[model samples]
Target: MRPKLQIACDHNDLAAALEDIKNVGDVVDIIEAGTILMLQEGRQVVECFRALYPEKIIVADTKCADAGTTVARNCATAGADYMTCICSATIPTMKAANAEIDEIQVELYGDWTYEQAQQWLDAGISQAIYHQSRDALLAGETWGEKDLTKVKKLVEMGFRVSVTGGLNTETLALFEGVDVYTFIAGRAITKAENPKQAAMDFQAEIKRIWG
Candidate 1:
């Protein structure tokens, strides 16, 4: 299956998110109410995205560390199709969050083992996000063999994996044959002078490689 494009509306400004979405929403497959946005504007940001794009997939990047059920319920009630939890959270916490939404994505950031991942899958969770942390990116990191190795292993383990952090057209080519369920872009599209064209460029590249 072809990979999907997801826009990360991670900035703190709702209006800015809306502006970028207005220009690129029709092309992207998912709209993420990013962590910063969720923090700054609350789930109201997710609600606002839903109000405008009723048919679109919205992810609340809540990174829930505790109170899983309540946080997941709140996000789902606010119109999130998916919510995220940090990988280090207890299995019970992740399972509790998974119970309230369509799906709960395990955000892979720090350290976690395949054993823990198996626990998540056994608990009815299926999605995982492999990220190159923003701080790491800022400190000069890029996706490479180590990332691909883990991503492939995750796919083989029945995970619908999403790769995020510093993704762009050039970086995307690195995963040409990998079955990434979604490729998340933040400033790559939102900060572009022409958001729509930026989205189109991503779609064009995705189709070129995945088709």
Candidate 2:
């Protein structure tokens, strides 16, 4: 199946994010209210995007560390289709957030062990994110075979994995073995000069590879 594309707007200004959305929202399947955007503009950004594009999938990238329930509920109430929590959060917190939201996405940011992922699967949370390490990105690394192997393992475990961090057309090919339910791109699309054209190009590449 073709992987769904999620556009990440990590900008600090709501107006700038809206401008980005206006350019590429129609082509993208999901819109991620990224951590920086949420931190800078708060849940209002999620609400505004939801209000503007009710048909689009809006993911609140709260990256919830603590108070998962409250954060999840707030995002859900504000019209987020999906809410995220850190893998480091307690099982109780995960359960609480999952209970309150329609869709809860857990981030595997160096916190979730294979055992922990299994436990989460047992608890009925099927959506998980496999985030590339920031250190690796800063070092100019690409998605290596090891990354694909991990993602394949997660897919075998029945989790719908979301691949994120420094994704672009050049690296997208590396995800072939991985059943990526969602591919989140931030600067690749949002920072481009022609955001709409950038989105179209990415979508075409996705179709070329996965179709």
Candidate 3:
């Protein structure tokens, strides 16, 4: 099966987000109202996206560190199909989030180990997002063998994995052999000259590698 394409709208502007969605919505399986967008707009962003395109998967990238249940319920009511929580969250937080929605996705920053991942999987958190830090990338690092290695290990640990962090046309090819549940592209798609064609390009490559 082809890896799902996720478009990340990381900015605060709703008009820009809607424009990108209008152009690329057909090829996108998941639309992530990114952390910035969520914080700035709250449920309004999620509700707006849900109302406009009911068929697409809407993810609330809350990156919840605590008070998981409250956050999860709010996002769900706002029309999120999935919600994100950081792995550093306490067991109670994780469980609370999972209770509200079956599809809680744990975002893995550099701090988490495989043992912690197992605990999350045991808690019924079935999805994992291997996120590359924007700060690190800005400091001049690049995604390479370590990303592939970690992604494969996360899969072995029993979490459906997704990856993000400055992914674009050229860099995305690096993960070809690794199985990913979803590929998240923020500026690469949303900032493109032609958003729909950009999405199609990513989808084409994803199908070639993972289909």
Candidates sorted by lDDT, best first: 1, 2, 3
Off by over 4 Å in 2: none
Question: TM-score winner among the candidates?
Answer: 1
- How big is the positional error of residue 112 in model 1, measured in Å on the Cα after superposition? 0.7
Question: Cα deviation in Å at residue 158, candidate 1?
Answer: 0.7
lDDT-superior candidate, 1 or 2: 1
Q: Give Cα distance to truth, residue 11, candidate 1, Å.
A: 1.2
> What does candidate 2's lDDT look like per residue over 22-99, in tens digits?
989999999999889999999899999899899999999998878878988899998998988888988888888888
Please rank every candidate by TM-score, starting with the best: 1, 3, 2
Worst 10 residues of 3 by lDDT: 11-20
User: Positional deviation of 14 in candidate 2, in angstroms?
Assistant: 0.9
Runs off by more than 4 Å, candidate 3: none
- The count of backbone overlaps in candidate 2 is 0
- For candidate 1, write residues 9-103 as lDDT tens digits: 98778997888889988999999999998899898899999999999999999999999999999999999999999998999999889989999
lDDT of 3 by residue, 101-192 (tens): 64899998868888888889888888999888899889998788988999999887777899999899787779877778899998888788
Displacement of residue 26 (Cα, Å) in model 3 is 1.6
